[model samples]
Target: MSPALALEDLAVERGGRRLLHGLNLTLMPGQAAVLTGPNGAGKTSLLRTIAGLQRPAAGRVRCQPDAIAYAGHADGVKSALTVSENLRFWAAVFGGDQIAPALAAMDLSALGDRLAGRLSAGQRRRLGLARLAVTGRPVWVLDEPTVSLDSRSADLFRAMLAAHLAGGGAAIIATHLDLGIEALRLELSEFAAPRDAAPLSGFDAAFA
Candidate 1:
């Protein structure tokens, strides 16, 4: 089968300032890819483009509908809604009953009845990840997924990602930490570096 998603000659600009140029990406089933770069290197911009939240200035991003799930820095949880309600809302939105499993996986099963706004920073981040799980999409596009997460919560998130990749799912994660995921690294900043100083193209590294 063809790759789950592909970005060909992707270029993005904002206010006449180029963010990304000559970017090409391919994600296949069961593979995980990570993007790493200094701040403002367009990692989030690339994620947003891949998620269809923003259009690339010049390029084509192709993927199957309902095949991708994205979680950005902002988790769109409603303060008034209880955790269970939030999960239910996502379930209804995604047309799946994976809410319970998602909550349980994130260790938020007991907090289901608590209002989302009452949750701590770590809790909110986990809840955001849980919402993504409910989508049940084959491809996951995550931006800074472990931000504000405690060690335990980070472990849980890593386990979730490991399971997803093992189950023929694909992911494009943008984070500063290594995440210890066996993945291909797309260093966006390298593209902006002088040609002689750039890292080799298409680098692969093992989980560490």
Candidate 2:
């Protein structure tokens, strides 16, 4: 079978700094890769590149269009909407019909009717992860997925990820917490580039 995702000599730049270069990876169905690096090491930049939210200065990201479901550091939830409605909205956007399973996978069924703004940080994070399940995509690109999750919610995430892999999905996770699952441990230090000063920021950076 073909690989679920591939990075060919992937070079990524952020804030005028070349963060990653000549990085290569291949993730097959049912496999996972954990990105490990300290702050400023470009882990988020790499994942954002894979998610098509950023452009690499060079190299290639190989995956089917719409194959990736990305969950970044931000919860990306609509605070005014109820938990269930948030998932339904994402499902509609992604053309998926499995909102119920997404809710159950995140242990969110009980909180379905509650407004997202009323949820605790952990609950909000779970709601963010649930969005991934509703995408019906084969590849999950997650950055800090367990950020605010408590033990139970974290376990729910782990279980959900296991199920995704068992069903022939792929995952690329950047996390410091131990998920207790066997995954290819990928470190980004070797591919790092040092910066002389803090890189660009705000409109000056964006418009440059």
The CA lDDT of each predicted structure is 0.83, 0.89
Q: What lDDT would candidate 1 get against the real structure?
A: 0.83
Q: Report the lDDT tens digits of candidate 1 across residue range 121-164.
A: 99998999988778879899999999999888998999888888
| Model 1 bad stretches (over 4 Å) | 193-208
Provide the lowest-lDDT 10-residue window in model 2. 196-205
Clashing pairs in model 1? none
* Lowest summed lDDT window (length 10), candidate 1: 199-208
Segments in model 2 whose C-alpha atoms lie over 4 Å from true places: 194-208
Per-prediction TM-score, please? 0.89, 0.92
Expressed as tens digits, the lDDT of each residue in 161-201 for candidate 2 is 99999999999999999988779988999877555534435
Shift of residue 162 alpha carbon in model 2, Å: 0.6
Instruction: Give candidate 1's error at residue 81 in angstroms.
Output: 0.9
